[model samples]
Target: MASVVNNVVAAVANASNDEAVCGICLDALDRKRSVTLKPCNHQFHRTCALQWAESVRPDIDRPCCLCRSSVREMVGRNGRRVVRSYPFEEEELDMKRQVLEGLLNEGDSFLISLNNTRDQIRKMLKESEIERAIAEKQRQPDEYVVDIDQEGAKLEKRKHAIDNLLEYGATITALGDAATVACAISRELEALNRSNSDLASEEEDGHYAAEQSHNEDTDSDSDSGSEEEIR
Candidate 1:
């Protein structure tokens, strides 16, 4: 059994990609830089693969970073190789579970930040238009031009962050090697669904906040009228 495991591991060591890049680190794979973490024949940067194997959560299969395949060792029992993950796989799996939770939290945080920025832009649009209308009636210069510039800057920053995120997603989707990407692709489809849900939630929250603010403003106006009548 030991000999069989050694042989398989040895075979995996020789697997190399011809100028192909490691999907995780985006580094070129060659004899020096690449290694195939076996049971799944995918080549990655030695460091990248180690980091990937290290990243697997406790409950899920120890996945090859590129393919999400179980990178288990075939243990020989009675001269027959049986699939049983290595000891590290168990540890890695636990660690991976933590990371999965962290990723979900991070995604929610990102959506919150995105929604806040969208709300700011919405508010700014209303303020700018109303201010411009008031200025035109009085034949006065629009004093909020600087505010508009600041809002434009904010919009540009938001756009750049979104663009980079989209490009990263595109790169992940463009990984065409079926043996190394199919499983990951399915997870990405699920991510797309989560993204849609996030957007819907953002829209609902925005509408609710707007309504609350409008009601508060109406109450403030009524209180001011009552004070004037008292005076």
Candidate 2:
């Protein structure tokens, strides 16, 4: 842990004044007193980083505040490696913190879209009577039709939403929350598709039955007329 903090020297002190601001403290390095995390370069105030690292005590693999990666070494502008040589190996520091500051907060923007999808699916299945579509087709078998435009819109929305979720899950640094959300949304989409397929199949069957019935009636009438003519 000390070695990680010791690596917090100003690697780019000459670059710009803004470059010297510590991510945690959000302030400039006090009197060239800075450190940079490595083997990749990121500078912070020595005390700011040491305090942050020290807070992680027993967990040496604590993530840096700037980028959620575990901290290992910090370096100075002069490229000198720093280490805690003092007797202070594990000085205890206590502070209550939210777990990684809720590394993917619950109220994330992504969740809003997920919730909307869920609601839409629920309303379609529970509120909207899909069976009506089948009934309508049965009543007018010759002109059996569903709103193709509406169906296409629903399909497009589901595809776009699911695609976004899968892509986001793939690219995210942390996949736990993202994967869970994606799976839940995917399941909802599957339910919607199944509902639509069943509705469409029923409608087709109704149309076929109506067509057969109409054909049978027409044949019976034609036979009656022929028998009268023969008499």
Candidate 3:
């Protein structure tokens, strides 16, 4: 009977030793690795603590394992400050922590890509606006040049018409001056012809009076000689 009692005590000691070891590899804790203890005084590898918590749960409402104090405190790097009756399992806690870290990293990368895309679109829009303004500025000079050329053409035509009118007026004035000179010469010649005609009529009337006086003197001398013969 004493031998049987000794075997039972040895079995209990071995079980106690196994409980103190890490749950994942069932290995003894080295000095380099830290051990996490639950509220139940159960110890495990720090890496295996989270895994145990997720696997041995009653439901999602009970997020922690029976060994952990509470769900919120179970996954933290440091153990819970206030100890409770129940706690999280080692395996469940490790898996939960890894999943959370992966999601956080993915979210950070997505935000960075979104910001870069927005910046590229804004730069493209600004460049397009600048190009449109430059094109409009370039067209403005061409429109102005066309307007100036049209105005110059109108001014040149008006100048040509004015020159033609001036030349025609000078030619008409010269013709009028020649006509006035010819009229003056014709009036002077008519006055000289009237004076010559009056002089010729006066000379012919004086010669006719001298011939009648000579004929009357000859008749008187013949009568006087006949009276003297009768006596």
Clash totals in order? 7, 11, 25
lDDT of 3 at 15: 60
What would the per-residue lDDT of candidate 2 be over residues 113-167, giving only the tens digit for each residue?
A: 5546545544443322453354355563321123322333454554455444434
For model 1, name the residue pairs that clash. 56-96, 57-93, 57-96, 57-97, 58-93, 58-94, 58-97
* Candidate 3 regions with alpha-carbon error over 4 angstroms: 1-20, 35-37, 56-231
Error of 1 at 48 (Å): 0.8
- Candidate 2 achieves a global lDDT of 0.45
**Candidate 1 lDDT over residue span 1-231, tens digit each:** 656544444444544535565555544453223455567766654444544554655467676654556776322212232221222223322333333343344533544454454455455446546644554675553333443344345545544444444344334333444333445544644554454465667743222101113343433322222334554
**What are the TM-scores, per candidate, against the unseen true structure?**
0.24, 0.29, 0.21
- Residue 121, model 2: Cα distance from true site in angstroms: 64
- Most accurate candidate by lDDT: 2
Better of 1 and 2 by lDDT: 2
lDDT of 3 by residue, 14-64 (tens): 666434444344555331122344334444444455345435553553332
lDDT of each: 0.44, 0.45, 0.37
Kindly report which residue stretches of model 1 are placed more than 4 angstroms away from their true locations once superposed: 1-16, 58-60, 73-231
